[model samples]
Target chain A: AQSVTQPDIHITVSEGASLELRCNYSYGATPYLFWYVQSPGQGLQLLLKYFSGDTLVQGIKGFEAEFKRSQSSFNLRKPSVHWSDAAEYFCAVGAGPTGKLIFGQGTTLQVKP
Target chain B: IAGITQAPTSQILAAGRRMTLRCTQDMRHNAMYWYRQDLGLGLRLIHYSNTAGTTGKGEVPDGYSVSRANTDDFPLTLASAVPSQTSVYFCASSVGSSGANVLTFGAGSRLTVL
Candidate 1:
């Protein structure tokens, strides 16, 4: 079974500071990676996804993630996070055509002014 | 565009009562899925339907039942609701089986079993 791990439970950062949310996965074969963001009382929105090709992938809202096969990591990063960017972030890995996605515990991002 | 619509955005059901969470998608996607989200745990798949007629069990399917009569609808039901079933449920859909099958999610249906 494929699984995702998000080490950080909560993250607090200043309004203009750079941010990174760590994610690790355990899969036997090439994994399909993705990052999603959810605001309070809302469904998740896809931030980005990595299928193949380049290791680094850019997504909406100035977010990016890099897939490292060697370390089995796909970490989400932002150059400067805004107050509006504060939300819960999730890392997920897809499993074939079943359309099943294994997600991480999630990280609550707090943007401080 | 109404990507996905889930009825009774929020609900409160008594224990042992029957409840059905409705999910409808306008995308006419080939695959639809149901997932429950808890406080500590990420979204866990409850059930999934590859197309209109084929349904499959997900990670947590013991307490839930689903039916896919057509392409647009995938309803999840609980014959006897329990306290442990209280959680926010989300409905998602995708085009088909692929490497980068991105899923579009519904607003979510929050159910509380009292």
Candidate 2:
């Protein structure tokens, strides 16, 4: 079974500072990877997804992730983060063409002023 | 129009009681999914339907049942609610079975089993 791992339990970054959230996955074949964000009491919103193509995938809210096959990692990055970007972020893994996603525990982001 | 609406946005039920969490989508999507979110555990799929009348078990299907009578509705039911079942439930839908299928999620249904 495919699984995702998010090493960070919590992250705190100052406003306008660059940020990176780490994610790793275990899959045999080409895996479908995704990043989702959830606000308090709300469902998850997709940040981005990577299937099979360019290693780097861009997403909304100025977020992006790069898929590294060698390291089995798909780390999310942003040049600058705003206070509004503070939320619980999750990394998901799915089998190719199945449309089924399995998510990691999650990493909560805190924006410091 | 409500993109996806879940009935009884929040519910508090006693242990051993039976409850159903309703989900409906108006986008005419071909696939619908049910997932539960718990603190420290991101999101786990409870059930999924490829289309109307076809349902599949996800990672955690214990104590949960689902039915898909039409293209728009995929409701999840629990025969006996337990404290372990207390969590926020989310309903999502996607277009096809492609690798890049992006899911559109509902606001969520919060359930607290006392």
Candidate 3:
């Protein structure tokens, strides 16, 4: 079965610091990867996705993710984290032709002042 | 706006009661999906529809039912609500059934079965 794993459950970083959220996925063929962010009491928003192009993909709100096929990893990165960047992050892999997504357990980000 | 809209942002219901969470999209997406979000579980897909008249089961389809009668509407129905069904349900739609397409999600409906 295809699955996504986010090792870090929670992370705290000072405002303006760099951030990296780890993600790993297991699938049979070349996988379609994605990163999503959910603000408090709001719907999830797509951050970035890796389908077939460049390994490093840019997304909304200055977010970027690098998809590494060797390690089955798609890690999200931000150069400088803002206070407003505190939210839950999820990594998902599109499974098969039906467009079903297998999501990882979310990582809660806490931005400290 | 061209986005997904879900009705009854939040609802509380007694166990064994019938409930329906409504979802509609103006994007004219060809694919619609229902997923339940829980703490520590991220989001688990309950059902999906590839087009107007087709539906399919997903990872966690039990205890939930759905119908896609038209292009815009995909309502999820719980025949008999149970306490375990309390969750934040999200409705999402994509341009097509291809895995490469991005999914646009609604604000989600918080359901509480007491």
Each prediction's TM-score versus the true structure: 0.98, 0.96, 0.99
Candidate 3 lDDT over residue span B1-114, tens digit each: 789999899999999999999999999999999999999999999999999999999999999999999999999999999999999999999988977878999999999999
lDDT of 3 by residue, A37-96 (tens): 999988889999998879999999999999999999999999999999999999999988
Weakest 10 consecutive residues of candidate 3 chain B by summed lDDT: B94-103
lDDT of 1 by residue, B1-114 (tens): 869999889999999999999999988899999999998798999999888988999999988999999999999999999999999999999998454689999999999999
**Docking quality class, candidate 2:** medium
Clashing pairs in 2: none
Query: For candidate 3, what's the RMSD?
Result: 0.7
lDDT of 1: 0.93
Relative to the unseen true structure, what is the C-alpha lDDT of residue B71 in candidate 3, on a scale of 0 to 100? 97
Better of 1 and 2 by TM-score: 1
CAPRI band of model 3? high
Looking at every candidate separately, what fraction of the true A–B Cα contacts under 8 Å does it contain?
0.57, 0.69, 0.71
Candidate 3 local lDDT, residue A99: 84
Could you arrange the candidates by TM-score from highest to lowest? 3, 1, 2
